[model samples]
Target: MTATSISPKSSPDRLSLSELEAYIRTIDTSEYTKTRNYIGGSTQLSEYISRGMISLPRIRELVLEKNSFSASFKFLNELAWREYWQLTWTAIGDDIFDYIRPIKDTVRPAMPEAVINAHTGIVALDAGIRQLQTTGFIDNHMRMWLAGLVCQVAKCDWKVGAAWMHSYLIDGDYASNHLSWQWVAGSYTGKPYLPQQDNINTYTESLQKDTYLDQGYGEIASMEIPEILLETVDVLPAHEATLPEDTVTLDGLNELKNADTILLYSPWTLDPLWRKQDKAIRVLLIDPDVFSNGRFSQQVIDSIVWFAGQVADLKIICEPVKNLEVLTAAIIRKSYPGITTWPGIVDEPEMLFPEVPVAFYPSFSSYWKQIKKYSMTDQQSLF
Candidate 1:
């Protein structure tokens, strides 16, 4: 499909890698940790990072170049958390949807209707949900609060809530999204994250009180599921778009048929500069199965299509990677559990601590300790 086919309405703000870098340079990390808990206090660079328009290594390098590590450590830590989740996902695979550890409390099998309808009576949370539905964006703190409300207070299954959230998120990554939900559900962490009314008030700047969340931690732990959250609702499955019948032919496919390398760009790896010097067939493969299961919104799909347009001679393929086995060799950026058919080269994500162990670390503290050991001594690289 042509880039012109993707309507601007279906895409979020479209920024090229250079434009994204300019935006990144403008981020003020001085007060990030102190103000990040409040809505609109974040850098809002997640969509670019998640979509691979900007890499983690580049972000870390850029931030460090502008500010001292001490000043930007919190922001860098946040970037590292994304890497930690990805490494954890690589270790566990599909098991991330299941409980990593036994849950201590009851969890409803289905999602609550109140959450789906955005009428949970929690003003800050409902506002966040509405923002998510409209713009496919939400701050991290609101995300935790929403997750806590859905998986802990609402008592819904974490997977169910996670899938609902993933459907609309422009920055949704299975590892980060699912694992965070599990963390809130007490499946990945030692305890479920329960946000009290005061906590919400402090972060959201709302004077809301007397809600079900307005209670002591002990009282909240012992409280029964609110009547509003007692009933479950069926979340309508995300609509899948029809793929093009024929893949677009690249300009050099015939001449490069005998070439030893082919760069494959999936939704996860749309890097414009990947293997630019090599004479290879560059294909943007969009597997129907991947999108079907991913349930990505039209906006996210549009953004992907737009990003793929940036690369010269990049052919868009609608079928699975397995169909392209005729290619001499394939190279791709490592992604989720699936998308592994004939991987000639799997490039690891550019991480701050590339040498850190990949085994699942139960807590970010455990993972961060290992990261700090290497990040402190490593020389920084700029994009």
Candidate 2:
């Protein structure tokens, strides 16, 4: 199986706050509700949200300033979905990688060769995979369709497919990517999410027929794994090993040795104004071990470095937190599991639904029920 062509132009570049605000203002909330299911329909803001380049509260505030909350509920709901995934991850911790519930059936150990090569012969699915690899972007509908194809139709393990997608997604949030795959795989939900050809045709505006998924939902539900999907492919994209040369010198860190506090930033917390008011040393920690396990692409790494460049006096350290010589009292935005650093101050990130407690809700509907009462409240006013 041959890999699809990678497009360098598709990589997400650094955007200034003004640029981000400009994009936010252009978002038409009315169009979002009517066309969100279509492949081309989306706010295209996930990349900004996933990298913590923008926060959920900021987006909600900006969206509400231009559109009424009632009119923009669909767009706000999508953002809340992102928050729900994160809250679920924080509740479950490392267990997010594991199946949330017992798997009803077993599947292949790895991703299907056809999916990796983007030659699944199913027109829309192949195009979505190609877009994901080449551009690191895909609409929410296509994401579900592709995940369902892998976990349900191809019968591959969700982790295998989820990891492959995460490696390429520009907005790859572990909480969102991993949990949504579990949802589609029937680990987080009752039934596997299967996408039929007609549904694909309706959303993608394609007319191709007689593919493996061309059958009715009942027929496709019980069919054996197709021959095309049976062949396993364990290939992951290769990333370059280049590190940023223009970085803050370690010499400057010596000045902060006696300082009372230091502000730490992770790849997920690249906010330039994180602690602008505080008088503290700023450090952006890039633990090599995290990347070794997460397997982010070179483009992702470069984009992160670009983000770090935006923050004033931010020193980018590649080693583990334990390797640092002086462990000053540090303040850090809470990150995902595997970050075991003992920071003196852990700042709670702004959540779309902060009123909802960080407890396990068996399903998203149940979780939403708890937050629905406050959904119409002005989010910025709550801060």
Candidate 3:
């Protein structure tokens, strides 16, 4: 395939670390993840930071001296989440494998062929799946749909779905992918997150075909998505906000904007792009690369890369699991420096970003109880 065929239709402007580091300093904490996803990746920014495109200590100092507590602490919270998961892995040691298996193997399979063929008649999903197979990205909302289908409708094992998703998603990571799959399958937090067929139809608005409706894909009932049990909202303490000494907010948004303004993930989310600050540049973020031999269609991967690249100029797009705490801290510190990064804010920081409110649902308490009991008693172990 031509290079264009495998990439997003548009090209994103390359970013530098100084640009992103600057962007991180000024952005609202609640918008961190969303904005990061929009900006895309920071490999380039990482390179600059490593090469002294900007000084870390300088940025840290600037945050402190200005008493820009919100920005400083928010950025720190983002960093902290990343650290937490990393530590969780170390603490659990071999237990992670044990915990993951039950979560992966518990579900039952209901619609194997429909899932495989992308014939479910839900347009956005079919498109998303095709994109997954072709390129590897299915936006956050679409990801929930696919995961829900694997858990509730297909009733397949979470491992199978995760494996399928991982094989293609460019952004896939073990912690986020596995935990997310488990959460949907009732293994993580313990409640299954099954979307009603109608929900899919409504959300995607692509099921005009009567075949799916007649086959009962449309009338299915909804399963409640579970809630997470957090210890305290303060995942990180304010004392940890270590801003480099020289970090400075840019005078204006430009390619010359400070090194901290780099985009970490998707760029489309930046209102300026939508407003046509750089229409051609923004258009380039759409991946022209369209096909691949993988299970996901090329479109998905390209879109993800495109979005990530475009936004990378402003943030750091990392494996959600890798930098979760840092991202979380960044948001918390950015939103409320005085709140004390506790469980309340850490878990539901969504409240800070009104655009992305906390999406509440049922908990997996019952499921975990049953599964744990079965695992200890009658359940057959599988390799």
Among all candidates shown, the one with the greatest lDDT: 2
lDDT of 1 by residue, 81-153 (tens): 8888888887767888888998867777788888878899999999998998877889998989889888878
Relative to the unseen true structure, what is the C-alpha lDDT of residue 280 in candidate 3, on a scale of 0 to 100? 20
lDDT of 2 by residue, 237-319 (tens): 55554544433445554555655677777777877767778887676777776665547766667666766666777766666
**Distance (Å) between predicted and true CA of 257, model 1?**
6.2
Error of 1 at 177 (Å): 0.7
Least accurate stretch of 10 residues (summed lDDT) in model 1? Answer: 1-10
lDDT of candidate 3 over 240-337, digit per residue (tens) = 11111222333322322222222221211221222224222121112112122343434334334444333322332222222233322222111111
Taken over the whole model, the C-alpha lDDT of each candidate is: 0.75, 0.76, 0.39
Q: What lDDT is reached at residue 267 by model 1?
A: 75
Per-model TM values vs. the true structure: 0.87, 0.88, 0.41
Candidate number that wins on lDDT, 2 or 3:
2
Backbone steric clashes in candidate 3, count: 128
At residue 203, what lDDT does model 2 achieve?
97
Please report the TM-score between candidate 1 and the true structure. 0.87
Q: Give all candidate RMSDs, comma-separated.
A: 3.7, 5.6, 18.7
Looking at model 1, residue 182 earns an lDDT score of 89
